[model samples]
Target: MSAAKIGDINLYEILGVEFEAEQADIRKAYRKKALECHPDKNPDNPKAAELFHELSRALEILTDISARSAYDKVLKAKKAAEVRTKQLDSKRQKLKADLEQREKDASYIQSYSTVPKTDEEVLQEQIERLRREGSKLLEEEQRLMREQLVRTMLEHQYAQAKTSCDSSAHRIKLKWKAEKDKSNGGYSYEDLTIFLKKYGEITALVMSKKMGSALVEFKTLEAAEMALTYEKGRLQNPLHLEWVSVPGVKVANETRGSILDYEDLVMRKLRQAEERQRLIAQMLAEDEAEG
Candidate 1:
């Protein structure tokens, strides 16, 4: 006996007998099936003649020993081919599953190797990460502090220079330092008078053509001081202004020096601030270690 074929019709099935049935059994099965399918017996049935014809052919093939032998060999070969195809498909699926499992194992091992093995090691990694973040934040804070301090100092200096006056100076004059390369085209005497007149009435204007410098005497001391404030405001690198040298000039308390040593002061303050933070951090770390 065998399982039924899925696609093509089997001769044994047409005769309504098992594959291993004897010739007598096959003939008995065919006789019974033929009676039910004969055109005369099943008149008005459209497929009655077709079914009877197929049964007759199956009986003819199975009764002849040579024909049955040939047909059995062909059926067996087809079954063998189907079995080999199924086996190949199963092997391909197994190979794919094995490959996927190996890749999964390799990835797991790689990731597992990077993980800290001990609780202490994991704690240390976390501490190191926190330390790096803290240091970055501290550095950024210092940078912002430095910029703010510098800006504040510049503003203070400008304010003092704008208001303070040296009453004892022989002349209320300001010296303009104009670098040769800075002058787009040399500034004219008329240009200086027009520009300086805004700060105060200019009593005298003298230009040193060779040196590319100018000296202006204001009508009042307040205007000269106001003009001096611009020294820190906009007249930077190539252009600068300072009080003209006077032997017994009365320097105001706030505007004693031409330039302040603000950079050194700012640096010292920053260093002290950093030292305090460092000590605090050290104490925290020591407490953590004790805990």
Candidate 2:
């Protein structure tokens, strides 16, 4: 290699050895690399001859004591120059970033710098803002009231429908107080059979051993109603009658005997919403008339 190209060439890299490698290690690396790119071994490759010559030259420079020392000086100078160039580039980038930030700050200040509003104009703006806020608050209040009214109406309707359905059904389930006597665990199916049968001909009797309750299905609706009148059936414990809750039963009118098939719950929800809107409109109309 020429003296001018000394900075461009790295002998250690060409020989595939570290700069601090021993002479024996450098020769070993060079031999291994030279075989890979030997002209005879890679006859079809045009770059093989050039690579093989470069490897030979690199090995010659790296192995010689005086030549290796001179090349090391050139490599150090090249690295120093690269570090200085990087430092200068970094400083230039930092200066450019600072200038851009200053320009942005100046632009922002210029955009906001305008003629100040009069006292009356500022007061009018405040009034307009307050008016908008007041209107929003009033709307929010009305929305909340409508939601609350719908919820209350739905609860009332559910209670009324359940009552009507239970009154019309021929089955009644009652919960009895837990027995105080430790000897008797709780009410069994056999214990309450005779007492429940007295009201009417019992179709079915289900005893909940755990809860101490019984569900009696009677042949006639009147029989079920009569059972509720007893309150406590022969047993010392007081009985509380609860209507059976069948799934999908939204209203009493839709039920047939014990088997109930009600309208879609979605329809009921929509109807309740419509009722709430009607009530609100009626109230508004009355208020306007009074005004």
lDDT of 1: 0.54
| Most TM-score-accurate candidate | 2
Give the alpha carbon lDDT tens digit for every residue of 1-291 in model 2.
Answer: 454464467778887788799988876786667656767657799999898777766665565565566667667777875776577777786786688699767766776677464332343443344344443432443355445445444555555545433322355666666654542335667767777778887766765433545566666566776777774754556567865542234244443322112323323544644553454455445535643
Give the residue spans of candidate 2 off by over 4 A: 90-291
What is every candidate's alpha-carbon RMSD to the true fold? 39.5, 32.4
Error of 1 at 277 (Å): 99
Clashing pairs in 1: none
Per-residue error at 290 for model 2, in Å?
A: 99
lDDT (Cα, tens digit) per residue for candidate 1, span 1-291: 111221135789888799898988976786667656767656899899888767765665566565466557556766775676577777786786688699768767776576533322333343344344443432443355445545556546445443332222313333344455646244667766766678876655655433445556665677777776653322342335666544233333334432354443334334543543454455445535643
TM-score of each: 0.28, 0.31
Global local distance difference test of model 2: 0.58
